[model samples]
Target: MNYEGSGHGLARFLAKARQGQGFTVGALGGSVSIGHGLKRGMRYEQSAYSELNMHRIVFDYLDKLFPAKNGRQIGGDNTKRGANRFVNGAVPAIGSDYFAMCFGHHIPEDVDLVLVDMAINDGFSEKGAESYETLLRHLLALPNRPAVINLQVFALMFQTIATGGDIHQGISSYYDVPTVSLRNLLLPIILQNSSYGISYFDHPPGTTELDREGLGTRHISAKGHGLIGRLTNAFIDMRIRDLVTGLYGAELESRLVPETPREQIRALQRFNTYEAIPAIPPKCLSAHSRSPTLIPSTNKGWFKYLIADQPGSIVSFDFVTAGGLVQLSVYRSHNAGLGTAACWVDDMKDKRVIIEARWDDLVSIGYTVTIANDLEDGDHVLTCELLEETKDPQKKHEFRIIAVIR
Candidate 1:
């Protein structure tokens, strides 16, 4: 398999770490990195029904190459128990932008190598690019200068490959980060190999079958995830071998250093330098009898939010800043009661932007949307007016203002 971008940084890091210099590996992404279809244990345990995801496989390989002095279990359980050096910080259905809000707290400071896999969830949004760059910049600026690898895994379809692959690749190139695209390896084989007796572009007939399991549509099956892990490990192995052999010449160290584009660096700097004003606690927001109510979030990972059942109800808040980019952290849910909201920034009199807040999942997940990116740096107000009640009669509008990232 051809490693699409460059893995110079990753190669150098692995080469050094392989010789008893143990390193901590961290992963942040969507379901693929989370081992969605695999069995879950108390720790990072893999049962008979479960297989190692890419993160786990990488950890397993690392442990093999440089065993820990006091190693515990070697599966998903190890990560949970902190017995393993790997940290899986992936949240299912999350995109690049969503990661920005909780990133400071979720990603550990001591992470030596970080693998990001969010190709499918990020889709093809311009904001995805911006947030992706932001994530990369944050990682690159870490004290340890961790090697960040962008992993792009695809479903059994061309469209999924094209969209997710392009966006991740673009970011990877801009930052000189190493990237691995599973589609790049599987596409040609899928097109040419008829002997596999499988539908290379679609899920197999039964969900229980191995081929179907291997061609997991949106969420990859256990076998599919295992294959990705194997391929990724192989790619890393090859790159490490090349580096050891001095195939990259004298410029290897320089090549490994990330050379982020100047414009992107400035954008990220602006994003980072901006002062953030916390949202008013949900308890203070007034709600009508028919409006969505403020409730304690069941998911402790997210900030508290408000939910509205009545259309036309409004959730308003104000903050002072020298206005620039103002981000709204809202809880978007696909379950019935959730509906779209028309966002008005600054003076209530002036209309800035309107966003349709909806999701496909029943559980409420926190999402960050840039409400006002170009506000004149100063005091500004934001209001999310529920436009229409959700189609689900039983469910009401769900909204939350978790944090305001300027």
Candidate 2:
């Protein structure tokens, strides 16, 4: 497999990591990174579902390349150990726009390398480009200056050599970071082998089958994921060697300037940063019929949150700073009872912004929704209320409050 994009930053980091000077690695992406559809062992607390995802494969490779000195165990079990640490920060079905709000707080400050594998989840669009660039700049600007590699894992149906692959290339070009496209690397091999009997572009082998809904959709099988992991490891090895031996220094240096210039980078850095806003708990507010109740979040690690399923349930908070942009952390689910909520800021009673509190799948997960932007600097009040109920009587429409940021 061939390595795509610049390798200067990645090479510098890998050289140190390869020599037993361990470093922490982090990943940010969606379901593919979460090992969706893979088999899991009966053990309830495995780091991943039977270790079938890309991040797991990369971690294994790192362990072998740089063996741990003390043989520290990972995930509180002796099943895995390595000098370097790994953080699988990927959340299923999330996009780059929600990265900072959802998983930013959890990422380690001393991260040395980050793998961004969100091409399929992000789709191919201009908004995807902006969000992708925003995520890249945020990682680069970190105090440690961690190296980032865009690992684009895709299926033949959702992405091809031309569509999602091209979009990722454009974004990577702007950041001067290394990128590895599974579409470009794996598709050619699959296409040449007639034994696989795959004639149509969309009907790639081991990618489509009858899922729970009896519909033919694209999902990489376990074997396919392994192939991707192997290809990525090979690409990393090649790039590291090239960079360390000074074979590609000039080409790598040329990428630092980006194709569009520095203005684009500056704009993204400014737009992505925000101050964390304090959320006022319901108990602090005056007792009212619509006040939401504080309860433990069904989505673990979120601590206690305010949740209400009844229509007209209200959660309000105040902000006393110069507000340019505000984000509301919410919970979304595909359950039939989930409904929608309306948000109002300050005296904008007539301008109620409706937010859908439903997802396409059964899993309940945290999401960040931007409620307001470009607000005047001063005191401001925000109110969120359940506006409607789902049609299903068994399921109740609910909204969860996680955090507020501006």
Candidate 3:
């Protein structure tokens, strides 16, 4: 494959890793997001026509190591179902449970590397982890126990940071796995804004804190995307470099792909907005005065849905922290189009927050809550305090749980 301009960098990165040594990679959780990238990088770095190259590389590597005979399936069938789709397929797989659900199928009898990512969804309880462990042990007992790279869920940043790495360390030792932690990689970046590689876009004044609407859609801004793209390329190159060095002696001559020139990467720092606010824990609920009531609609084995009334109440949340800023604006329906409220949070003498919904009315619904940024850090009380203000008190619906936000 002839790669020019930006593509050349990607090409060189793959070739070096392939010629250096090979690896049979089996990815577990978050296969589509993290593992898909790894497989892509591996194939591209190794040679031209490297997209499905992972399938070919894995097949060849495993064949040499295990050498299958008879009409037996090379790797187990369950794992193969999903893993094979990632190979020789145009579109990447979607959904969180795809890999874990298919665990019984694809894991090979002989494996080299196993990359696992769990905790992506914070709502998943401990039972989910236990189930995964059972499957993991089954795979580990195979002929060759693969080297495991367990990617800690980025969603648990607050919990993990508070533990001083104990949680990750215990997990690693428990399963005898190596942890490829994003926190370790991100600590220095957070310390220095410039070191963050991507610019943190500051929202305009009088806007909700880090709320998607105020910042606009697309999590990363345009400049942020370019910076992220470069950082991703550099990170992949570094990982491949380390893997190659481990497999082959360091003295081996190899062309390591260089990072994108700093000057070439446009920095959006000029427009960076400075705000003093704490980061909200992922998936946690927050409510502000005069915002819509947030209700957990449906429960799916621990994953709860947010439900709310439609067309009259407004809700918003401060996803990011801000210093002493308290102007709250209601969001138009997110799932519904604009200029409509989904639910209502009653104002209590401008002190406490109340949520009101109709129990009698039957409607296909969702959940939402108001989030504000102007409250000072101290002991503040939030209660589920439901009101039966509908036509009849007996006909009113009560919100059982009201998620609190500091």
Top model number, TM-score: 2
lDDT tens digits, residues 46-159, model 3? 321232222333334333433323211323223332121121211122112222223323344444445454434211334344334433444443443444444442322222
Q: What ranges in model 1 sit over 4 Å off?
A: 1-6, 19-21, 39-51, 69-84, 156-161, 189-205, 208-216, 247-323, 331-337, 342-353, 359-367, 374-396, 400-403
2 against 3, candidate with superior lDDT = 2
lDDT of each: 0.58, 0.58, 0.32
**Cand. 2 TM to true fold:** 0.71
Q: How do the residues 1-406 of candidate 2 rate in per-residue lDDT, one tens digit apiece?
A: 2246656566656656766756677777766666663443322224343466677787678778766664533432122333577766666556665664334543565677888876765556666666666677667766567778777776544323243445767667666777776666556666686334132222334744322222122445566567677877887788767866777564453344223222343333345434432322111111111222222212221223466777777766775445456666566766635677787777786776777777664434455567778688787777777766564445567666655655
Give TM per candidate. Answer: 0.69, 0.71, 0.32
After superposition, the stretches of candidate 2 with alpha carbons farther than 4 Å from their true spots are: 1-3, 40-50, 68-82, 156-166, 188-218, 248-307, 317-323, 329-337, 358-369, 378-381, 389-396, 400-405
Give, for candidate 2, the lowest lDDT window spanning 10 residues: 280-289
In candidate 1, what are the lDDT values of residues 128-205, reduced to their tens digit? 777677677767656667778777777543243455457767667767777777777665775576334243223445
For candidate 3, which ten residues in a row score worst on lDDT?
Answer: 85-94
RMSD of each: 8.0, 8.1, 18.7
Give residue 401's error in model 3 in angstroms. Answer: 27
Report the poorest 10 consecutive residues by lDDT, candidate 1. Answer: 281-290
